[model samples]
Target: MTSEPAERAGVPRRSLLLGAAAGAGAVALGAGGAIAPPAQAAAPFVKGADISWMPQMEAKGYYWNNSSGVRQDLFTILKGYGITAVSLRTWVNPSSDPGNGHCSIEETAQMAQRAKNAGMQVLIGFHFGDTWNSVGVQNPPAAWAGMSYSQMLQAMYDYVYHSCNVIKYYGVTPAWVKIGNETNSGICKPTGSISKPAQMTGLLNAAYEMSKQVFPSTPVLVHLAQPQNLAGVQNFLDAYRSNGGKWDITGLSSYAQGGNVPTVLANMQTIQSGYGKPVMQVEYGGPVGKPTQVRDSLRAFVTGVRGFGGLGTFFWEPEGYPSFNGYNSSAWDESSRRPTAAMDGFLNV
Candidate 1:
């Protein structure tokens, strides 16, 4: 995610990865960004959105409408658009800030249950902080500040374990569990930064193991932002693997790439092939007004990734219309209060 606190806060997670360069020790990407799709077919692809802001939006009296202009529930509208799943983010103990906070475990579980009731699969994103964690900032929770590495590891484990159990208690089983959101720089701040590979992997392992213990069948994802930065992603994953990091899926964020689908696809191909993991586009979005362009880009990406056997993509906050929280990349229409053609990208894929 990007570094802007306001923008990141508005999305209930990280901002779109923008302008960030590769980290130190990064490898140079191979020449020629374009790559042919893999031979394997990707079936049961997940077409989803990160609607973590729905509860807060609903609380603020925001609503959605169908094409005919009739008010409908958010999930109903999303289902009509062919969204098969929803991604929800969680924080350690978020504040009540209207734009920035309110992703506590209880709220996350409630969202999960709602998604399940809607017959949509759930992706649980653990931010591992009181607010947001992305490539720009991975601040450890306030309660975990100044904690020794070992202490924080236990804290991370307990938090993930308890959170998973609570979600299960609410009768919702997650389809995917991300150890951290956009953890290109690693999670939980100084102690878990990618610069310190050992500490990073240690914390990741704790989160991974605990998540598996709870949902042994769910895929645990290791997410990194900015797939366009092939070197940065490769460096982080190299470190992760060298340090014995474990994950079932390699999640990526493809945003603001200036329509360079070839580059993004190349990186996804490399990661899926190199790490031998199922690569997924966990977050993506285009500006709100360019519905046609956004729709085309989304369609291209979904088609390209699926062609290469990459996991499905999730549009980041497509519901953020009228520029809610200063977010301008949502798929909703400002005046009509209905979904634009942007979401058509996910259809017929």
Candidate 2:
């Protein structure tokens, strides 16, 4: 669910709120004042965490202890570390996984309230489906199961508009909203797939238009995975624009894989130079135990993106339990559920 162009032409306005730090558990990544609160808790350069999973984790009786090994409220601790923003993902009608209370729209609003109370900017990441919509499978909500391509566009529009209003009514207007999640194959696929370029553009355009109508000032982005996959990024965006798609910022994903940091940075530059769109590393993660290298890699990534006028770098689930989808490198100390040394990159920036 997502809107608008405060950007040049078709690009969306960008705030770049993602952190490129390692997964967090315990022992905050850095020890310094450099990781000050997000520019007085403003909109741009919002330093923060994607602890959308926190609420669900809480429901499952999972709690994090502070550096003192005392259990503490998570957001309070993040704020203490100068984390000034929070991100959440909502599905059209998400599944009720026992550990997933935060995926529902109402539940997400509840978390948004918590984030706002913690003095953090909120980002509404709408996957626009019943579950995660990523590069592999972009399923539409069951509600749209039998709809035609034209009908799907209207559904997207309505979904986004409704998501905007829900968050706004809850007293936490999102600073950013994504039209879809990791939509390299296009969103709500098959008819709305990038393979069907024109139809996909229609779907995205509908979401874009309806989002602006609801929250005209909020920036909207189209997310894609693997910034290092330059061809994928280029092809998808080009297809979107050529088919009359509109977006504000170009949102990307980057994870440390086989020493791909340089390629990630290079791809960001390529997107900026080729599309003239401000880039935002919306998702990044590094090795969990390798504190020194993780810190340096994250720093280099943030620095590299900065060199090319990127909005910012964001870590996907740095504080995740089970190390972010079972990849140990992606999470901070799962036991502590706090920051690790890799967070030094975000802090010192």
Tell me the lDDT of model 1 at 322.
Answer: 57
Each prediction's number of clashing residue pairs? 0, 18
Give the backbone clash total of model 1: 0
TM-score of each: 0.87, 0.82
For candidate 2, lDDT tens digit of each residue in 252-317?
877764367887788788887787556777777777877667777877877787777777777666
List per-prediction Cα lDDT, in the order shown: 0.80, 0.69
- In model 2, the runs with Cα more than 4 Å from the true position are 1-44, 99-102, 257-259, 323-330, 336-338
Stretches of candidate 1 exceeding 4 Å from the true structure? 1-43, 256-258
Relative to the unseen true structure, what is the C-alpha lDDT of residue 270 in candidate 2, on a scale of 0 to 100?
84
What lDDT score is found at residue 220 in candidate 2? 73
